[model samples]
Every structure is written in C-alpha cells, then in structure tokens.
Target chain A: MDLSTLSLGQYTFVQNAFSFGLAVMAAATLFLWFSRSHVAPAYRMAITISGLVTAIAAYHYLQIMLSWEAAFSAVGGTLEVTGYPFNQAYRYVDWLLTVPLLLVELILVMRLSKSETVSKSVTLGGAAALMIVLGYPGEVSEDAGTRFTFWVLSMIPFIYIVYQLVVGLKGSISKQPENVRGLINGAATLVVVSWLFYPLVYLFPLIGLTGGAAVTAVEVGYTIADIVAKAVFGILILTIAMRKSEAEGNS
Target chain B: MDLSTLSLGQYTFVQNAFSFGLAVMAAATLFLWFSRSHVAPAYRMAITISGLVTAIAAYHYLQIMLSWEAAFSAVGGTLEVTGYPFNQAYRYVDWLLTVPLLLVELILVMRLSKSETVSKSVTLGGAAALMIVLGYPGEVSEDAGTRFTFWVLSMIPFIYIVYQLVVGLKGSISKQPENVRGLINGAATLVVVSWLFYPLVYLFPLIGLTGGAAVTAVEVGYTIADIVAKAVFGILILTIAMRKSEAEGNS
Candidate 1:
C-alpha cells in the first residue's frame, strides 16, 4: 500500500523467494512431462495439465523476478524503489490462468465418470476464476474498506472451492485405488492449506504490517504458497497417477 | 565488435529476433513435454530430452532478452549502447549444454543395442560439447586470426558429428521400423543442414560485415539456426517416436 526503503536483508528475502519459485516450477514442469508416459493413457492428460500449470507458473515467476529487480535497487545498505512500480499483477495473471487448470487437472486425474468430470470441472473452474478475479481489485486497492470488501467477495468462491475439495470430491477420491486413498486425501488437504495461505498473506497490509515488512511478508508468503500449491500439488497428482496406473495394471 | 548507433528499424529487427527465439523455445519445450505420452515408453526419453533442450534454450533466450534490452536504449530515432554489454555468452553457454544432449537424445531414441547406444552417446555427446567449446573462442574473439583458428577447430567435431549422422547411423536407420526409417533419415539430414548454418553465421564478423548490421545479421541468423536445430529437430524426434510406437503396437 505504501513504499518504504528496504534494508538489504529484506530485499534479498523476496528476491530469493521469487528466484526459487522460478527454479522449482521449471523443474517440476519437466519432471511431470518426463514422467507422463508412466501413467495410464486415461490419466495422461491430467499429468500433461499438471506440467502445463507449472510451466505457466514458471514463466510468471521469471517475469516476477524481472519486475522485482526493476522495482528495487539494493545499491548500498538499503533497497530503494527505482520508480518502476512492481508488476504485482503478474501474480494475479498467473493465478487466473493456473487456478482453474489446477482444479481441472485434479478432476481429470481422478478418472471420474465423464459426465461427473465435465460437470465438476465447469463448476470448480468457474469458482476458481471468480475467486481470482474478485481478489485482484482488493489486492491492488489501498483503501481499507475497498480491500476488505473484495476480500469478502473473493472468499465466497474460495469457500466454494474448499467445499468442493472436501465434500464433492470425497466420493470420487474414495473411488480411487485403495493404495492411493491416503495420498489423495493428503493432496486434497494440501490444496486447502496452501490455498488458504494466500488470503492470510493478503491481509498483511490490513493488519499492522506496512512498508517493507508488509511487502516482504506478502511477497515471500505468496511465493511460498504458490510453490507449494503448484509444485507440491503437481507432484502429488503425478504420484497418484502413477500409483493408480500400477493399481490398474497399466504401468 | 564496435558499437554504432542503430536506426530504430535495425534495433527492432534484432530485438524481435531474440523475443521470437524466446517464444519459440518456450512453446517447443511445452509441446515436446505434452507429447511425451504419445510415444512408447522406450522412446519417451527422446521426447523428454527434446523438452529439456528447448527449455534450456528458453531460459538463456530470456537472459539474452534482458541483456539485449539493457544493452541498448532506443528512446529516439536511433538505438544507442547503454553501457551494459549484450550477453552474447548466453548463446554459447546454451549451445554448450543443449548440443550434447541433442546428440544423446537422438542416439537414445534409435533404440540401438545397449552397447551401441552407450558408445554412440558418449562419443557423439563428447563431440558436440567439444564443438561448442572450441567454437566459443572464435565466437567471442574479435581478432581475425583467433576467430578463424577457432572456426576451423570447431568444424572438426562438426564434421565428425555429421559423419556419424550420415555414415555410422545408416545401418541403424535401416534397422529402424520401416514406418520411421524415412523420418530418421530426414532427421539426420536436418541436423547437418541446420548445424552448417551456425558456422556460416559465425563467419559474419570475420567477413567485411561490421557494427550494427553485423550484430543484427549474426543474432538473427543464429536465432534461426537454433530454432531449426532444437525445435524442428525435436519435432522430428517426436514424430519418429510416435510412429515407432504405433508400429511396435505400443501406442
């Protein structure tokens, strides 16, 4: 919400977070791509989509790193704004594209009956997009009232996604091979927990946090959550796909 | 080797070339990754490595882009040097890494006997690396003697690789499934022609070409060669893999 001079330590913290995000997302994308043939044909598209999500994330992370460098110059003891506004919109743009695909990839890998897959994909994908779109205005707003309003608006879709993951996906996940049921449940939990971290980070400025502290908090926080949500979640999806492929004697 | 003010048209030509290189590499990486599952498991590594080669190229192209933008300022009718050096090393570094893997991936997908695969991969991979390493001296050196000396040395491994692709691989190509034999032959031819483009481009500075025209010529020329070598060559690998998979009844 406001610019503050950053101590070198504070600037490096966010810089490392974004650079690490790029590396992890890129590595995960390739690993998923290379491992795609290990899954059954029915679930291969899910693995492909997982790779797509991470590749998209990797591209954004690269842009984020550039924007971070452009916005701050830590020349001596402190990091000062270079008057190039940090393109924080890269994060929202990434989320808008990937969040829906994340939901779709999970649904696809479950190998749900066609009608159910199509229905759930549409519903959850729409909710994810809505959540991101509603959150952006709030994310960029400086006024506490406007920010809080969009936060509340955004939470509506967030809760819906959570509900779908916890309740609606329960039966489908149950229908997964017995060996992967626990992993599936863990993945669903991961999605909820990691996704939840974003809103908490979003509220940092609204709380007492401000200036470098608030900016660093949100940057580092959101970067960590994104890595977990995409990289970790993609790994879980790949593992489940492999295990299910084996369970089905397709491996 | 010397800086000159560039007309806006000259600057945009090179800038667009680097940007296009970045986009093409990124797209090729994703395409190869998503198509990996379409091939039989035995051939999937070739497809996976194709993704990797393109991905590595993409990363360097991103860096090259940053350096290109940083090295020039075209605020008016002319583009002027910005005191930052254009990171031409990124291109050589990329070539060093991907060139070896490009050879190895081809050897791998041929499904030679284990011993033959190992032998060819080692020899060809080593040759590719040496070619790039040898070429870099000439690539960066402005001295005519130094550049010409390295050029001749680099061509040693280049000719070796082309020989292996043509002579040594003839039997291997003939042994391949009939459905993919034509494709294999074409791939070998593609490698030779594309790689030949590099040395010609490398000679640009050695010739009468100078200043921005020389820079633009080499940048655009090398960018085209790289795309054809990695992206087009990679597509051939994937097509061969898919055809071989189908012929083997493994698809």
Candidate 2:
C-alpha cells in the first residue's frame, strides 16, 4: 500500500499522536517548573535544564510539522519555507542547552561528594566544551560545508570531555556515595554507547558504508542512543534531587 | 546497493556490532549479580530479576549466532524468509525480562514504604501474567492469525498492569520516603514511556500501516524504548540497593 494514499483516518491518527506528544512535553515542562522552587539550588538548576530540553523538543516537533509544508511546496509551483529559521535556531540552542546540563550534572554530583571547588569548575568547563563540540551542528544536516567544518571543530572538545570524565572518575571513585557512583558509571557507559556509533555514522560514508538505507539506519540508531541517554540522564537527575532532599531533612 | 553483494569486511563489521552488544549484555549480567548481595532481601530479589533478564538477553544473542547459518542461507534462497524466528524469540524474551524487572523494582520501592505483602504480590503477579500473555505468542508466529490473537490477549494483561500501578501509586503516595517515592514514580513513568507506543505498533497494521519497513520501524522504536527502560531501571535499582545497604550498616 502506498503511504502517499493514506486515508483520512490514518492521517488524523498520526497527527493526533504528534499532538499528544506535544501535550505531554508541555505537561512535563510545567511539572518541572512547579517542582523547581521546592528543590535544592542544584536540583533547581537541573529542573531548569530539563524544562529547556522539553521546550526545545516541543519546538522541534512544531518545526517538523512546518517542514512537511515546505516539502509539499517544494514539489509544487513555488518553493516556500515556513520553519527553516526556527528549525535552524533550535539546532544550536539544543546543543547549548544540553552541554550545560551535562556539565552542571557532573559538577553537582562532584559537589555532592564535597570535591575541591577548583577541580570541579575545571572539570565542568571541560565537559561543557566537549558537549558543544560533539553535539553541535546537530546530526541531521546534509550540507557538506556546514557538516564537515562543524564536525572537525567539535572533536576537540569531545575528546577533552572524555579525558576529564575518565580522570575525574578515577580521582573521585573513593569519595562518591554508592548511588552517585552507580549513576556516574551508568551515565559514562551511555556516553560511550553514543560515541561508539559516531564514527560508524559520519566516518563510514567516507569509507563506503554509504548506501542510502544504510545511512538512514545509522541515523536511526544514533537517534535511539540519544533517546536512551536522555531518559537515563533524566532519571539520574531525579535521583539527585530526591537524595539531596533526604540528606537535608536528616541534617 | 544490494546488501547481498557486500564484501567480507562489511559483513564482519556488522557481526562485530552484534558481538559488542552481546559483550555489553554480559557485563550487565555481571553487574546485576554483584548487586544482589549488597541490597536487602526484597531488593536483592529485584537485582536477581535483572540478572535473569541479562541471562535472557545473552541467550538471545547466542541464538542469533546459532541461527546464522539458516539466516545467511535464507538471504540467498528464493524464499524471502529471514531467520525471523530467532529475531522474534529475542524480542519476546527481552520484553518478558523487562516487564518483571520493572515490576520487581516498583515492588521493592513500595515495600520500603509500607511493608505490604499481599497487594504487592498480586500486582507483580498480574504484571508477570500480562507480560507472558503478550510476549509468548507474540514471539511464536508472524502469521496474521497468530498475531491478531496474541495482540488482543496481550492487551488484557497490559491494561490490568496499568490499573494496578495507578492504584498502587495512589495508595502509597502520602506515606513513601521521598527518595523511594521518587524512584517508584520514575519507574512508573519509564514503564509508561516504554509501553506508550504499543498500541501504535499493534493497531497501526489494522489501520493500514503495513509494509516491512514500517513494521520494522515500529519494532526498532520499541527496542529503543526497552533499552531506555533498562537503563533507567538499572539506576533506580542501584539507588535502592545502596540505601538498603546503608540502612543495614546503621542497624
């Protein structure tokens, strides 16, 4: 059956799913906001970070809807672009948002261990830089000029972040609470999982693993990894929030 | 672009990815085992459940390798049959493993709150039954007749588990320790996130979302969600394990 000939009911169903996803995001955002004031300062920051991500995801979905219109117009009389700028704006905004979130989370975890202030700032800064390099340009762009330049520039910080995490984990291994240690280790595993596919994705094309569907499969795999990372990271932050409050009450 | 024409190197790379995945599963199993002796008896059971899941995943990977000869032969044969039996077996085993792990984690959290036994067992048993109903026949046949019958049967248990969780949450909402409560809530959310797409996946075909690729996309989406659930649940289990150990030490 031709997808293009989708019945009205089918179209409505897909549209409704997308709409429901948007509503869920909005609700999550509000929930984060409401809980923000009650949490410790560090957790409040994490909630703020989560709120930003939810907002970006909502915007991304809206932009996807606009891209549909752009595609339709591109096929007809005159080409019209409805959401390119908004889409492109969020591309970098998403990276900026995630980078700080990752860095802040790492720092907060370290601080919970009562690590040296100087070392924590340096480590957090390094992680932030790494996130910028790896996550920049987003993963969807096909423009060679943009993709290649950003890809090259992004590796510097990515390597640095990996180095810092390894060093930090080694140094702080003895000091961390068991739960925090487990979370850090799990998050590190997820980061490695995400990065392991990067070369296979971007570099494989240059080495001839570039068939159309194969490339599509790689992208889908990366997206799946990203989603897993986000979900795990969200749980980690929630744990931090709850644990911090427990500690406070006992004190 | 025919996949069959791929040289030895490409095939080896793909095989290596699967092997790497298997290795990760092995590591996860080891982690689960180590966790078992560190938590309370109730929480230890949860960790054991996770270990059981890891074992199933390991077995699934081994099955894939064992079925490789048939899989490769089928690729070259006139019949379009892939070694989908092995694939389906892995998928169902993974789901069954996940459902129990999720329920056990929730039960451990609830146990921390009120020490209620009968209600927790009923809820967990209901969840296990639902998982078995959905998972068993879903793995056995791809034939429409079997698929339709199993899908309907699966829904009965799925709905029941959801109802159980909702009621359980309401009952324990005010009494739970903040940390344990957060963990339970997060676990419930993860379960919802993992299963949210089920209806989309099963009902879509009835609504005319056919074709191999479309079906594969939905399957992959579910697989990714499963990974996310495992990662988040792993963190939650670790949190409880650590707290249980700490409480034991204090006593």
TM-score of chain B of each: 0.96, 0.71
Question: Per-candidate TM vs. native?
Answer: 0.55, 0.49
Positional deviation of residue B45's Cα in model 1 after best superposition, in angstroms:
1.0
lDDT tens digits, residues A1-251, model 2?
01233333433343454455456555655665566666665455455555544544454445434433332223444333222121223223344434544555545544544346446655666566565545444343555566666666776666766676666566665476665667666666666566556545665444455543443354345444444444345555656665655565631
Give candidate 2's error at residue A173 in angstroms.
13
Native contacts conserved, per model: 0.06, 0.00
- In the order shown, the chain A TM-scores of the predictions are 0.96, 0.63
- Give the residue spans of candidate 2 off by over 4 A: A1-150, A153-251, B1-21, B37-42, B64-70, B73-86, B112-115, B134-146, B208-212, B244-251
lDDT of 2: 0.53
TM-score of chain A of 2: 0.63
DockQ of each: 0.06, 0.01
**Top-scoring candidate (DockQ):** 1
Among residues 3 or more apart in sequence or in different chains, the pairs in candidate 2 whose N, CA or C atoms overlap within 3 Å are A130-A157
